[model samples]
Target: MTEDYAALVRDDRVHTMLYRDPAIFDDEMERIFKQAWIWVGHDSELPGANSFKTAHVGRQPVIVTRDKAGAVHVLLNRCRHRAASVCERKKGKASVFVCPYHGWSYDVDGGLRKVPFADGYREPVDKADHSLIALRTECYNGMIFATFDDAIMPLAEWLGPARKWIDLFMKQGAGFGVKTLGEHRFRFPGNWKIQLENTTDAYHFPIVHKTFLSSLDEDTENLMDVLGQGGWVEDLGNGHSVMVMIPDLIDLEENLDAPIPDRFAALAAELAAEGHDDDQVRRIVRAVGGSGFNLNLFPNVACSMAFFRVLRPVAVNETEIQHIAIGMDGGPEAANRARLRLHEHFQGPMGFGTPDDAEGWERVQRGAAAGDALWVMLNRGVDAPDGRPEPGHEAGDVSAETGMRAAYQMWKRMMTA
Candidate 1:
């Protein structure tokens, strides 16, 4: 199945085996996830010099750490002796990581800092040679990513037009930038691709999230009705793409129940000092850091307005998803709490939106196990104009499968490379 993904993948749709085949899943781990720039975590997650987090780049365990000098590094978590993991913790501040197996110690910079019994060694064990394997790491706008393949393109070049959307999301906080509030994780009994495709799928909103949408007030419902009409999808180059809903739902002031965020006030004051008026401040706040964009970073990262979705593939039929709510760096505590509540409303395990989506994805997995379903149709908005210069209207446009197609195209390129 891995050998002939091109033959298996339909031009307009993909076969069910793509989701159920173990061989294809293995190939994906190697060809797609490892080769691409997989987002490890945000820089804010490890702000202190000794802060660190454990992440998986595809199936490979990785440690993302900041050295005493403040340089961030991504290294394989395996120990040199017997291949034991050097760090078992998920996240914490540590001066050094020691292999529980042989007490092989490594500094935060991934250099071999010490060895338990160096005098007993017969053959000379160079500390440099025994250090943890390092992967190519890069950061863009404070987002950290690592790749197994050093030949891969730089994050900036790979991001292309998608960088603009990232900038917009970053602009939410006055000048401090965005931070991950917290994450809710869950396993879906389905392939990772199923969830990735759903992120940009505007078609599913009215039907799948109908109950949640209906719960909103009349104005919000009107906006939902328009959203149900369909929206613009664009190919942001590389494997990145976007599915935008028009008029920027977050921009509407009808539901400003949350207290004004202190960051917003600070930004407003800064703008005022720079000679801006109240209306300009309001407009800036209304944008909600690019409230209109559902930006997708190819392979495994997605930033949907105020929240983030990180995809982790566990196996052929199982995927783990992490939903993170973002907040302003120094924003009002109340506003950040409101953002968390809003995230919980939709993305939490028992939330109004995620449960339904997870159910749908699980059903897809179950159905695909039959091995007879040949095509999962993705022909929605295949002929629509690609959203480019039109900005907000792109979110309202219906005929746009550009995002999905872009992802699949990248998949094909990587698989066949």
Candidate 2:
């Protein structure tokens, strides 16, 4: 078996083994996931002082919580005593975590707080040395990210050129922050990278999501016709990129008084009745509308439209996706309701879009299993208007493979680093 990771990713194509081989997946977990900053959860999930949620980073179970002091912390869920997870629930408000396997208790900051008995062994165990492992955590625009490698670059610098696009995506919330409405989780028999690439994959939308487009109003359907416009895909460094179609929707936060689109005709007067001013009405409308940029944030997250899609790799060929709907924090109640419906219509188990995408991923997995085709082609638009002025920035059409090439460029660098 060859361990040449470089040869797996070419300028125009990638090998199937990158998505199928168990060895390659494990290597990715170690090199890419552990070392890189991975998003865990949003700060909005922690509403109060003791709010906490469980997440995974590179196969390690983690607890993301706000301590009694109101500071956020990301601690390993594994108990030091018996290696059992201290936090069992997915999310809750807990002052401390108690290991079910043993009576060892830990504070929100993962400090060893108590044991069943203080004196049982001849040697006095040092509590300082038995603290739960904690990762370096940072929050940017309410998104929480953690890393096991302390030597990695600062989170702001690490996000690199991605910060601009992230700022643009957040503009849908219009000055106020966005909160997680809820999440829908589903597992597929495919590698996680399949979904990662799918986020910025504009080429598949017109083909795979044709049903979704057909159901939309003709005016709204026009939004999907960005393929012919001057729209372009951008490689935003550090494995991040965006397939942008509607540039006008990027920073509606600045133009709060912009009129609501025709799609929200039913909500305009209702918003007026709710005492919303013109600016606030526009803000609420944008929150309900959606973002045009499908912002893929490297290893784990895709801030797509109005939802946060997270990818978790469970095994070599198995992956789970968490689709979280986001709504403006203080927006009109009616607008938020419409936003939730929009998310459900597009992303949930019953949604029209996800089922089609899941089928696509499964087909790719099955085809790769044959080992007949060594290379998966990503050569679309390669001979067209492709521009790479720098190492981490590139430009091409909305349906171009610029994102995949740029992502793989960072992947190869990180894997071989």
Candidate 3:
């Protein structure tokens, strides 16, 4: 019998089985993660030729590498023979990957370079045909994504309306290119969708992060009032969404004349003392503070206000989340340091925000054990709407569940296809 995945995901709610059933989880791994453009790494992560990093597309481990010609390849980590993993390091510059089990080696582009004891085989092996499997990889702006399905649309077309928002989010680079400084990775007892929904759920910000708010200065606290701001959540087609928490900070290049906030005042003074002009100082400070919106791209990645949030599903009840800190590629040291400090304050494992959010998501998975008949309600802001979105996009107030609904609809589409 068919699973009827569409029936499980309605316009306003999804069945709790989505967070508890291993069968549904397995289906999602094949349907969505394998079929969709899964974000693998950023341009800065590879840096130059031979740079590589380990990543996952669903449960399949893969290696993201940049070849000598600067071409990026997402190769299956397993060797062509005996299925031994060719690489194990998280990231580094590597010209070749040698399987530990055997001396079989592959080039940075996953071309099988050599095999030990080749004479033992009855027939001569074709190196070209024995190369590691490679996924279709493409990048937009500085973000890289890979997919197993060759027939799916290009990353840009799949991104659709979200591309504009991605361009806006990149403005935080402050004229310099964006670079991934580092990341905070942690595993939580929850479904990946729970973390996905939380990225755009402004309604939980104040309640769940009350202590984080209290730790901020009064002015900073006021600025962090996401729901009270004239903000809105827009569904940016193909499961992507953007939650604008501070409209004033939408364009980091705009409002050059605005006074620097208290938290950034000292940094601004340091920049000025370093001989930076007024305009340059303001621009750097604003970039360090990050953008005002969270761009939640479908499946596994999100540009969450100031950082890149990537989710990896481990099981029906386990998810690994990575909060990647980004900074200007060649920007001033002071500005980059300020960005790191800010990331540490809220996104670090012991930071004021992450622990609390992790606990909340864990509780959600724990609560799922209570019943199988309940649904995960996602009807917020449906009856009463307050703001308009972009011309072709669907939107709701800042605290709405519009983003979650958009994601679930996409989930249903892929699962039922």
Candidate 4:
């Protein structure tokens, strides 16, 4: 019998089975991932014509390529002939992909270029019919997404209210434009939604990342106190949410004249010495620090403060995460260096934050095995101080579980549809 997904996901809690059930995970791969526009890659990753990168849309592997004509395409990685993967390198500029199994060649646009020993075929192989299977692809800002369901709504309409927050998040480019510098990929024994829940989860930040906060300078440590700040979380429609951790840093360009922080003071001086004016130095410095909010896009990707958090489900009890560090595309070297250093300090592989978060997610999965009927409580912000939302805060305070609740509701909607 098909499970009732709506019953499993309530307004304030979700069944533990949602995390531990293989059936539910498989259903999610088909219903949520295949039907929704899954984030595949960034425009910057495919720097120019003929560049490509490999990514996963749920469990199906796909190749994201920019053709010689500069158009982007997401094609099935498997060869049209023998099902062998046509290309395996992580990313690079490639004009043609040759399958190692049978030496079938394909173009950057996934058009079948040549088949080895074509004369051996009894029938003429139609190149148009044999090209790599392509999916419906779309991009917003620099984020690329693909979907198997061509009937689904356009990406922009699906994004809806989330676009505003995405625009603010991209302003970290500081007018130079945002580009991917690198990424850290790690796996933990836990459900993907656990890490998804972590994106907008402020309640666990202080407790889990205590060491990271302690490592920060005094002034910066105070600034990292996200829960105590007057910031709040808002439920952007379509299951997306934004957790504003530092209200003052919400719009990086708004406070260009603000005094530079003590930590960045030296960097600011360095930029000025490099011939940048006071205004340019301030803009670059502020951008290097990243935005103040974590915008969790539904299902797979998140703009988490300084980096992009992407989750891929390996199994019912396994999930792989990518913490993609972004920097100014053509900005000064010193500024990008500072941004990389800051990213390394907290979000890197050996950094203080990710390890702690992975531990917490693993523990949650371990504990889920203990009880068969227990529910994962998500009632933190169900009721406000006065039993009503604050003036501008319809979701809740910074530490609320409103974001997770929003995600599960969308999950229920998709799974039942």
Candidate 5:
């Protein structure tokens, strides 16, 4: 069945075809992922010069590297000669990237450094001409992002309202800032949009994550329930969005099993050595925000509390998700371990949350294969609250499908452009 892209979306609801259609998925890769300032990795991921990580901007393979001067660069992974990926490993520190196929090598800055048998060529391969294709890379609050399209707007202008949410997430550790706690990668036999929608989806939590929530103590359950009740959902413009569920957790009674991590203790000790008092350290660690907040950056990044989730599409019906957790850098080792444990609880492949969500997404994919399922209703709490700033919320309001709607709206705009 042919799908009307415009008709598939209304202010209050959307059709399932938006999620199921292969054509729409291809268009999104071009108009959305290719053009958008997709999150590549955190600044902390590449701690020093020569550190690099491979990531995908849509289906195109890209590499993010830190040069000797500590400058970050994003380059197309293809070799100039025959288009083979220069960096094969997922991540590592290297002064230069060498292609194993034909021994073509480039510096960490993506400058063409060496080519095997250079003298044999009639037209000398100009190092500048054969340099790896570079992408526009920028950082905000230590988060790295790159755009394939040179004409795209600056990162700050594109961030819009989403910057506030990122600021809040960053504020968690305050001056101590945050650091990634590695990641867990998994593949889902479903569309990537299915996972993106879930990032801001609050309605399904109480049901889908019921068992997981039940595992937590009463206090945690109360917080989860509060999140289910209603929370902030905001469209931060340019398809970026934030779904704040609960505020900072400083007020909560510390559960025995969930005590301040020993890493925090080490951090406190370090702070003490640096002349900070006990109170100051306590305040800093406590303020490292983690209650229940989910912040989504446009097409692919979701910063949820202490963790970040990146949704990468492999196919119309296949997706790969990477979950990365972050904590204060060199802060208390205890706190960092605690954050890792917390991430493990929900983000791990077999963790309480992800596996459950995966099941739901797989079901959606199976249902969509029928072809007769025309739409996926997003009419939750349509009349329950008018929390949006505009006349009609553009997906990002309590009980609102603001994020989903914002994504589709951007999709339609870009596709039609």
Candidate 6:
């Protein structure tokens, strides 16, 4: 670690090089991401047997697949022969992954299936030693996570106090587990941790998204106040945290057919015609409307609004993010359509919010290299009126910097440990 690394992270501030230094970024990939339980894909993504999705765990390409026997596997994408990628597609159903370089193939369970032209081998090619490498995988609800360190704690245990929050989050899908409604992928010239910190950092919403809010139908003034109304930021331990909107003013269970908010009046008829009773309507709306808090699950996966923002670190100063919308798998088509629209309105590349965030993160990366400032402040709510200590953790106003402080505290732990 560089002298700047420790000097950068203090109790209330961090230095600029934390985001701009290539060497430091490499260290983070090894020390933090490699050992952490990273959310790779939702089980819903690989719905059928032999279904697979290509994903990353700490810069390593892996294939998360469901075998014919219904068991799930997280296998390295690298071919056992010549280091070529056996699977090329981002995701789809495949009986086996065939190496493009030499036709060496592996089954969905990651067993070496064939080596073309068998006579070419002099010795009995030790097939047992050459199957694709697999990482340990586990799931909670429908979300799947994988880790390179097989000895690390299981995913459920690792989620720590964040488990109940996951339960609360998945409830947005009601009894029907949420399914992916596709995604919008984009890259930003910024570090992945910057995006991670941004998710639970409610303090920036009012200032950074001011123009976006004012354009919406809701009362912009009170809209910002929603962050203050009943919400509190909480650190959920093990790098996970939440900006909880308690009493769930925005969640579905509370909103129901109670005269739809004026902003979503256009969506009311569609909700009604779905043939659901009032309570049913509420659940439908809540599930599809993506009524929940912002859940930052450590290294990746941010449950925000109608979508999950997934971050992939491509380089020291480059990050690729995916915006994934969710809705009940077997739910009404109209409600699902509405979910997709809402996801697009606020989160997609051309939407009301994401582009602005892109620019903001890029700005942070650029700014870090400019000045000689030794510390970037995360001291918004350190004491008194701004900060409120709670059981097992701390709390603050929705617009407070409590979440950033919590995330950094976790970051320091992972990067140091």
**TM-score versus the correct structure, for each prediction:** 0.88, 0.95, 0.97, 0.97, 0.89, 0.92
lDDT of 6 by residue, 179-271 (tens): 888999999999987898888777677778777777776552464444566576677777777776534544455556465555555555666
At residue 23, candidate 1 shows an lDDT of 91
lDDT of 1 by residue, 1-417 (tens): 327778666546777778888998998998998899999999888978899999999988899999878788999999887899988898999998988988988888788887888878896679888889998999988889999889998988888888877776676554547878889899899999998888787777889999888776665567556354345678887768887775444233333444445535665566567664665455445544336557888989897866778999999899999997787786555445656776787786899889999999999999887757577766555555364324444432643556777788788888989
Model 2 misplacement above 4 A: 254-259, 383-395
Full candidate order by lDDT, most accurate first: 3, 4, 2, 6, 5, 1
Cα lDDT tens digits, model 4, 85-145, are 9888999988999999999999988899999899999997999999999999999999999
Displacement of the residue 45 alpha carbon in candidate 1, Å? 0.3
Question: What lDDT, from 0 to 1, does candidate 5 have?
Answer: 0.77
Q: Provide the lDDT at 77 for model 1.
A: 94
lDDT of 4 at 102: 92
Candidate 1 local distance difference test against the native: 0.77
- List per-prediction Cα lDDT, in the order shown: 0.77, 0.84, 0.91, 0.90, 0.77, 0.78
lDDT of 1 at 294: 78
Candidate 2, residue 170: the lDDT equals: 81
> In model 6, how large is the Cα lDDT of residue 52?
96
List ranges where model 4 is wrong by over 4 Å: 384-395
The positional error of residue 151 in candidate 3, measured at the CA in angstroms, is 0.5
Best by lDDT: 3
lDDT, residue 144, candidate 5: 95
lDDT of 2 by residue, 25-90 (tens): 999999999999999998889988889999999898999999877788999999999899888898
Off by over 4 Å in 6: 1-5, 219-225, 245-247, 254-258, 264-266, 384-395
Q: Listing every candidate in turn, what is its Cα RMSD in Å to the true structure after a full C-alpha superposition?
A: 4.8, 2.9, 2.4, 1.9, 4.5, 2.9
- lDDT per residue as tens, model 5, 1-417: 334677767776777777677898887798788888999999988989789999988999999999888899999999999989898888889998899899999998889999899889998889999999989999999989999889988998988877767776776564577788789999989999889888878768888998889898676677677344446676666666766666444232233234445535565676677776766566565654374578877789987777788989999999999998888787766657667777888886889998999999999999887756566776654553333433454433454767776776776677666
Error of 2 at 339 (Å): 0.5
